[model samples]
Target: MTSARRWASVAAMLFALLLAATVIPDGQVFACTPTRVWDGDGPIWCREGMHVRLAGIAAREMDGSCRPGQPCPEASALAARDALVNLLGGAQGRTSTGHILVDGPTMRCLSTGNARGNRTGAWCAAPSFGDLSCAMIRTGTVLRWDRYAHGRCRSR
Candidate 1:
């Protein structure tokens, strides 16, 4: 072939090689190991195989009793705690004071009175989930039953 044709062919081959390199997945580059744990209020970037804990609050009373047009008198703030335990496949236990222990995450109940009682709070943490970013743990996931006894099932 001519010199110009040969150079064109070489350029095409180089371009194809570059494209392949960009498209192909590099196992070494993609492979990720477990992340370390840090203290404080934040998220944790964890590996798939690593274990973690999410701390939060649990509702003290969750009775299914209410009247029409009223909220439930008892609310359980155990959404995130429950979800984390389910995801990690860990057992849940409780302390003598009724504190829930799901792996490393501890869920404590703040109040246990009527619907208008003080709202409960919880703190959830996963050491091996993601960085201490806002996206890691959501507020609603660690929610409080604020509108207790305010919905349609309040009287009951």
Candidate 2:
């Protein structure tokens, strides 16, 4: 191969390696300091760059709609979102994209091998809230998704 071609190939390989390094494997346990929240059942942006969707629960979408078969809670979208932000230590501010910056404590999350778009489905535990999934359910802001919950909510 020409010198230029060799350099391009090496660069491509390095880029692939970098992407793989950021991919969290199924069932991996990771810690994330949540910096922003999209809604109650999150796509919470972490300081580490991992986006987490709270596993075992469903909340109203930001547009105030719940996808057909998901547990549609009685709570409004803003209600649910605000409740989650409060649980995370309250909203620090809002981003240009409309996500609320949160002052939540660092949380240890267990990935459940599920993905929704780019976010990982995780069961996370915050210091103030032992289990976020259960806490959301208890607040009536979200509902337990039994398929993903796997009886964890029952015990809690």
Task: State the lDDT of candidate 1 residue by residue for 1-156, as single tens digits.
Answer: 999999999999997655323311111112112132221111212332212221222222223233354333233334433443343334355556433443433211121121221111112223543321122233233322234212311113
- Compute the lDDT of residue 107 as modeled in candidate 1: 18
Sliding window of 10 residues with minimal summed lDDT for model 1: 23-32
Alpha-carbon local distance difference test for all models: 0.29, 0.86
Best by TM-score: 2
| Predicted candidate 2 versus true structure: per-residue lDDT over 60-94, tens digit per residue | 99998999988899999899899899989999999
- Stretches of candidate 1 off by over 4 Å are 1-76, 84-89, 105-127, 132-140, 143-156
Look at candidate 2 and tell me the lDDT of residue 75. 95
